[model samples]
Target: MSETRPLLEVSHVSRVIDGKTILDDVSLSLERGDLKVVIGPSGGGKSTLLQCVNFLQVPDSGDVFLDGQSAREMSRRNICEFRQKIGMIFQDFNLFDHLCARDNVAIALQKVKGQKKALARQRAMAELERVGLADKAALYPSQLSGGQKQRVSLARALAMDPMAMLLDEPTSALDPELIGEVLNVIAQLSLSGMTMLMATHQIGFARHLTKEIIFMEAGRVVEAGPPKILEPGGGGRAAEFCAKLAQVTGR
Candidate 1:
């Protein structure tokens, strides 16, 4: 890839579900190690946008590019390979109820990456440790707290050695107290230079860590720019929305 090229690009993407347009000609780009935050009200299409970027929900129009390669042009097998290189973290902790934390993280490594059981478990442990969950590795999802379960989810995604991550409100399902723990891990990932595009309602956290914020409304990117665009009196849509959010949350 050329030095000027983006690591990930979503070009003119649109998605329609049951005649309702969920996305409308959305486009964005992420350079290697860049972190971009997508913020909007519920039902504004942030999740669908992220899903399209990862090809989890194929767009009806437009294409996604990774490392200068077009996803729409790739074969079915190639699309699967493309997804493996980009991790998706969901709002719910999607760990297997029957698997312990270690096995939960190791399962994808073994099944998807074709690693041997022992090596997969080894890598799983390292990732669990990275997320500060090594001590809980023996625990099953049923025994873990909401925060721990989310950490296990993070470990599972990290075990894949993803080049970039798309997080869709990863902390949304957690309790207020639990939100911080997961946010802390995400903060660590950002500081470690992980390429991430996150859709979140944590405006304060997003403002502190992200250089750019993309504000979506009614299936369109209404505003996008530096954190300054969200500052008081900045006059951007993002700033106005955030000011209202602050009034409600009292933050």
Candidate 2:
């Protein structure tokens, strides 16, 4: 791919379930190393859009390209290869409760990449350290707080050394007091230049973190641009929504 071209290119994307549209003709271009945040109301297709980028949920019609290669044309094996380079974070912190945090992170590297046990554990430890949870590495998810579990989840994703990360409302499930910690870790990732496409309810977080913001509603992108573009009298529903959110959030 040309250096000038975007790292991800999504065009005319749409999804439907039982004839009800979930995503409607959405399109975006993400340059390499860009940090993007998507914001909208609940059930506004933000999660669905991230899934399409991660290749976890295919759109009924549209094109998703990674580094200029069409994801649609890739074989299952190729898709798996593509996915290994892309990390995903979920709102629920879907850790395996039965396993220790370290082991949870190690499983994917060992099973998916066939890494040796010794190496995998080492990698897990490094990732956990990065997320500021090295001391809790041996603790099971059941033993950790919601914020700690989310940190471990992020460590697991970072362990894979992914080219990009897709985060779906990752802080939504945390208690209000605990939310800042997880967001701090993500903020560090952004500063380190980890490409990310995040769906979040935190408009202030979006304004501070993202280079550009994408606004989705019902099933489509109503607007996308730098934060300054969302000023009052911006002339779009997306900007109006953001204005309202800013007022509510008191940002």
Index of the highest-TM-score prediction: 1
For model 1, residues 162-242, the per-residue Cα lDDT tens digits are 989999999999899999999999999989999999999999999899999999999999999998898889897888888
Off by over 4 Å in 2: 232-235, 246-250
lDDT of 2 at 56: 90
lDDT of 2 by residue, 144-201 (tens): 9999999999999988889888999999999989999999999999999888899988
Please, what is the TM-score per model?
A: 0.97, 0.95
Candidate 2 Cα lDDT to native: 0.89
lDDT agreement with native, every candidate: 0.93, 0.89
Candidate 1 ranges with C-alpha deviation above 4 Å: none
- How many clashes does each candidate structure show, in the order listed? 0, 0
Q: Compute the lDDT of residue 158 as modeled in candidate 2.
A: 88
Pairs in clash, predicted candidate 1: none
Model 2 has how many clashing residue pairs? 0
